[model samples]
Target: MQFRRTVIALLTLATFGTPATAEGEKAGAFDYYVLALSWSPNWCLREGDARGAPECAEGAARGWGLHGLWPQNERGWPSFCRTNARSPSRSDTAAETDIYGSSGLAWHQWKKHGTCSGLSSAAYYDLAREAYSAVTRPVVFRALDQDIRLPAGVVEEAFLKSNPDLDPDMITVTCKANQIQEVRICLTKDLIPRRCGTDVIRDCTADRALFTPLR
Candidate 1:
């Protein structure tokens, strides 16, 4: 009877042990990583308006932040855009002038092709000296968080297959703490794009500028 009891106990343990070991192996099979990026509000100002102005003005003004995780890239830099301002002027005026003046500084940093001609001649040329002074100002980029695990042979095949626009090299993995919360992907750059020959960045849907890579 004692021998029979011992054999039964050993069998029960083996049945559970096999599955538990397999579960551990599955969990440990792949490495995981998280990446994070943040941008200041200065980075959100319209690039066209901020042109020729010192980069520091945007940093000094109301700042904004953007965060995300992406796969590692060997040669790509983080990108951001400036915010757009609106005016009711038919041609040009003071309100439009102010908007252009502020946005040009931002454009200079993010859009290599930005110009400040949309403002009236007086306003456009008046701020040139100030813009030139801030021209050499450095814009800051920071990686607030990172949790990269060493490479494993296995990858998250499903995730890679679903997101094609995202560069595989810049793929980011995110985990939520609460089951009810949803993950969010945010575009931190200004939603508006720069005009062809204007310093103003408009917020109207019909006039929105599409983001292009800075040259």
Candidate 2:
């Protein structure tokens, strides 16, 4: 009886190694990476009120905050790959919260995107922070002294100007209604800037998108 129970247990373990790990065997299997940066003011507006958001309140008008570093392929992307699902280690506390601008965002990103990177949680997040550091925020985002609206092309130009190596094809601008929502840039697996496939680009159709200044 004991032997039969043990055999059944072994079969179960073999059938389902681990929920997260089972999917992880293919982690880091991607063609490129997309680093998305959210425009803070617009994000706050979408969420409801800037008065309640930490990134927007108390004079904390951080122009751009990381959305995520997603691993992608030329055709489609993989998600929720495998992971231990453990929390970020002690050393990654700041990057997981402060650098990401929110602990919740950090957690979600790690589970959704970072897990697919095939990197340890700390390493994946550190890579994301590094990717964010590589991007030069466009001058327009530096300080919006007043509310302004500009063509999507103008915004793309700003990014190109700030990053000499970046071409229009490398940056994809997304907007929500009339507000600029996020800016996504393509990069190589090693985090070097690269030209992304046209299909992966999701540009906003708005003729002019509003750029809200820090509150």
Candidate 3:
């Protein structure tokens, strides 16, 4: 298991170059978090390779799950810090595999974003899971019961209604080829509602998007 985690860690490094900070410097500490909740049905259907992804498996049918809790700045974000950090803690690896629905996904997010947060692997994952739980999903799922297609604005509004504390600016809907893919919600490090920067608001250029029924 350690060998596999090491391989995954090195592979991630190859993709995102190693950070230049001193060995003793803090890593992954950032301004805010972008809790991205992916719509599983869209991923399973549109991205065929991820068809049998556990997050969207028949028995689970998880409507939306944590894609990642990324560290972001006012302009951009941090990544690939602590070039030598090991894989997520064994405890986090086990718990997050179920929460993230894939061991690789859990490991990748921690390697990419978690290391930069300057938190221990366990604390980082605790925050990630807490962030996931802090945001309620029933409202969106309640509205998406059937196989229906709707404008992207409606989905955003539903989230706002469900989470009354959020403003129109705090959340954004992402779509691919008019299919709703994910909902990006902005929050402070302490998990309070936050407004995303203007530079990174929405993903889809489309005014309308489809919502495939949850599997």
Candidate 4:
């Protein structure tokens, strides 16, 4: 009788508690959540003293390096960071570390925060610029023909119109003389725009094809 009681107790403990414990452990393994800033490295630096720092530093510091505005998860873990960094100058070009830090910080932030919400006006402006860039000069754009015909000034207008919440100065457009096919758009936190020759341009051939001339 004693042996049977002990056996039943052991079975109940394993059947009722082990799986829940395992799942809880698995869920708890992830540590933080991330909020991505979309402004270019140049604008990121101009925004503030802390904006250009790597995400790891922001996460560690528990805010955008400003006082008393730290982000916290339900479990109270700090979840966001300013992981972007400026490109190394010619004198110090050998740095091979990630522009941010390890994948661990990003992973942890994502796990904890899930997604960022209720961004400040500055953050929203930065995010809008990123979305505009994604729609216009996406990474996939490079795969298209370099010589593909693109509409003139349409890229600039479209980017600006798409992001109305930003200040006018935040959306600057410029084109390259050598690569007439290229266009670049820049947005800053203070809502200033600075055109750069090296920036990618949006192509509007697909839109032009959708409208046909009537006889």
Candidate 5:
């Protein structure tokens, strides 16, 4: 009876995978990072306006805002991993609102992807800010004075042209409901440009994705 119970326990562990730490997977165990930049105007049009997101206010003129810096694997990603890192305080999250558009997003990013980085909350936020500054967002997008519909590849091409170090494989443009959403760039743990994993390389093929001008 004891032998049968042990065998069953082993099988359960094998099937469910071992929990190395607390109630989640071990932290700091990822291959690379994905920097996500959201087009603020488009997002406002999609869902922010309804939610009354302050970043969507008229004349905000927000272009590409930091969405998150996500820890990713070669084929998958980690989230909400167990870590001993301290959570960001309200002030810590507030400091990132300029880049993230809201303290709520900053908080969420730290809770989800940031926890998986294994870095202390402060270090993770600092790295996220650093990564955002490293990318050269295309000035052309901000020059738009009106809403327009263009091929999604145009957005990708602009990014490639603006950041010579970024190759086609290192970045991807995502769209939703025929609207341009965000530009996701893959980088090394040290924040250098790198090819994205296959799972992160999915690009939008919309021939006429709506792009809204900065407010």
Candidate 6:
């Protein structure tokens, strides 16, 4: 009898908990979206320079570039979901190069995040473009003439000041290798500002992180 009771308890625990999303699960099963904006100058200074990436060319003058529009859940996110949607054509990916830095990134974003959106490649790209346009990236950062180190919170504050609609809870700044990495904002599927999930609201507490100036 004890053995049967233990088996039943285990079944109950497995059925009721919030599980991390499995790879290649059903599409469009997420709760919200995270729009990641990468600081291009910082990327150039970090990984891009090592790879001799064209985006890091001396005169590019890149700023905040669209990273990806990731689908998120209240607890755990989905990725590389199974979908019947066709992959994006080369031209479709190329159309996004102005904001995404390369056609390859756009294609990769579609395969990873866009597949889980339940939208066709065309619709997903359109939505991604629309979300990128809605956010107001701070202009003051562009005026930076030289590298500086500052608290990561200052970057978050500047974003809040520029975008009054975004509350502190809706956005976060992340750091990598003591350099400012990406600014992530949570939004509803319809592209309205929303509070991020607990897992998504991790703010970088670094007192000083390198900020590279644009070319």
In the order shown, the candidates' Cα RMSDs to the true structure are 23.3, 9.8, 9.9, 21.1, 5.7, 3.8
Highest-TM-score candidate: 6
lDDT of the candidates, in the order given: 0.26, 0.78, 0.75, 0.31, 0.92, 0.93
TM-score of candidate 3 to 2 decimals: 0.79
Model 3 clashing residue pairs (backbone): 27-116, 28-116, 28-117, 29-116, 178-210
User: What is candidate 1's CA lDDT for residue 150?
Assistant: 21
Residue-level lDDT of model 6, residues 1-215, one tens digit each, is 99999999988877555445556868999999999999999998888889887888988988999999999998778999999999999999999998999899999999999999999999999999999999999999999999999999999999999999999999999999999999999999999999999878989999989998988
Candidate with better lDDT, 1 vs 3: 3
Judged by lDDT against the true structure, how good is candidate 5? Answer: 0.92
Prediction 4 global C-alpha lDDT: 0.31
**Sort order, TM-score high to low:** 6, 5, 2, 3, 4, 1
Candidate 2: tens digits of C-alpha lDDT, residues 113-138: 88888888878887998999899997
Candidate 6 — which residues are off by over 4 angstroms?
Answer: 1-21
In model 4, the worst 10-residue window by lDDT is 61-70
How high is the lDDT of residue 185 in model 3? 89
Against the true structure, candidate 1 has what lDDT? 0.26
Q: Return the TM-score for candidate 4, rounded to 2 decimals.
A: 0.23
Query: Which has the higher TM-score value, candidate number 1 or candidate number 5?
Result: 5
Per-candidate clashes, comma-separated? 25, 0, 5, 14, 0, 0
lDDT of 5 by residue, 52-134 (tens): 99999998989999999999888678889989998999999999999999999999999889999999999999999999998
3-79 in candidate 1: lDDT tens per residue?
A: 99999999997764332211111111211212222122223333323554442343334211212221111222222
Model 1 is weakest, by summed lDDT over 10 consecutive residues, at 194-203
